[model samples]
Target: MKKVVLITGASSGLGKSIGEFLHEKGYTVYGTSRNPDKITDSVFRLLQLEVRDVESINNAVAKLLAAEGRIDVLVNNAGVGILGPLEEIPTDEIRNNFETNLFGPIEVMKAVLPQMRIQKSGLIINITSIAGYMGLPYRSVYSASKGALEYVTEALRMEVKPFGIEVTNVAPGEFATNIAAHRYHVRVSQASPYGAYAKTIEVINSQVGGGDDPALMGGAIYKIINTPKPNIHYKVGPFLSRFSIVLKRILPDKMYEKMLMNHYKL
Candidate 1:
């Protein structure tokens, strides 16, 4: 039997790359986006979905189930990044970020788990970020969102293990995706006071360079999905993530904060 995979936020970036990679590997792929028309026909089956809306998510799954009968893999890749000081960010903006980044995946998983449980097999691959493990200067809310996702992925892994469903969280450091450019929310009012700090944020963005190639992340996701027994988490991108992991393990809380402040020049 051919494996069927459903990927969210598949209009572009890592999600689209994963969809294309999986399709090339001979899996029946269903890719979902807010604007399905934007998805290329060569990639996979494009389904209209808005992760922020529970109704849209449920409806998309219903349509997929009606057509394909089963989904073997669920890739929750739809997420938005909100970059700014925690105090400066709007309450509504924070809610919106959490809705799309955290709750969206949770709802989609809830919708799919019933069928997956009945089948006694499935894989849930969540595209988290390096920010999930460590905090950055201007990305407090975004980091928090991913941190919540990391925890959710951990909990879900244990919950679904008994049902023969595997959950994997792929944390990519940086990919050459428009996510940084497209998703950043800068509040000029809040930033005006921190003139030098605002300039530092720009420098950090320039250094990150939109991340590594999206294809690298695509390959990593492909490997995880294809593995006979996937691990709980797969970290991709440059060696910097490894360094951060080591630092996280070895450094004290205050010291770690100091180190990060120095490294980013924040």
Candidate 2:
């Protein structure tokens, strides 16, 4: 049977790419957006879903189950990026990032798990970030939010294993997505103490503009879905980004920090 897949935040960017790719590969793909009526060119079905709202999450899940009767895969790809100095970022904004990047995905997973468990098979893939593996300048909140979801996947995967559910995190490095345009930025004044912080945004944007293809993430997700035993985490990006995680594993604490500082020109 063709697997049924539900992908959130699929209005555009990586989520849209993944959804389109899977649709071509013959999976039944349902992509979600706050306003599905506006996406006129989607190759697959689009559902109206707002991850921040629990009712929206449940309704979308319930609707999909009603149509398909079983959901085989879920891509928790709905997330927003936050930028600027940590100290300058407001507490409420930080919480909001956690809400969308962390809590929202959790709620979507919760809504799908019962039906998945009943079927005795399902896969949950959380779209995380390479930045989640490290603390980068001006992206402290984004990193922390994605990083928390990574940890949640670690524990949740083990807990759900007995019922045949597989949970994993897919961390993508900078991709040429409009994530930059949509990010929640903490505007710093010209005389802010964190002078280097403002300048780093340029470098970050340049990298993302020149980043790897977003379809690569789709390919990565497709492969993981086919694998008999998908690992806890799958990273898709430029070699340096993926290797940075390795460097973090072996390099001394301060040395790794220094490398990042130098990379960001901080």
Best by TM-score: 2
Q: In order, what is each prediction's RMSD in angstroms?
A: 1.7, 0.9
- Measured against the true structure, the TM-scores of the candidates, in listed sequence, are 0.94, 0.98
Highest lDDT model number = 2
| Backbone clashes, candidate 1 | 4
Candidate 2 local lDDT, residue 191: 83
Q: Write the per-residue lDDT of candidate 2 for residues 75-154, one digit (tens) a residue.
A: 99999999988888999999999999999999999999999999999999999999999888889999999999999999
What overall lDDT goes with each candidate model? 0.85, 0.94
**Residue 101, candidate 2: alpha-carbon lDDT:** 97
Tens digit per residue, CA lDDT, model 1, 195-221: 456766775677568567788877888
Model 1 misplaced regions, further than 4 Å: 40-42
Task: Quote model 1's TM-score.
Answer: 0.94
Per-prediction tally of clashes: 4, 0
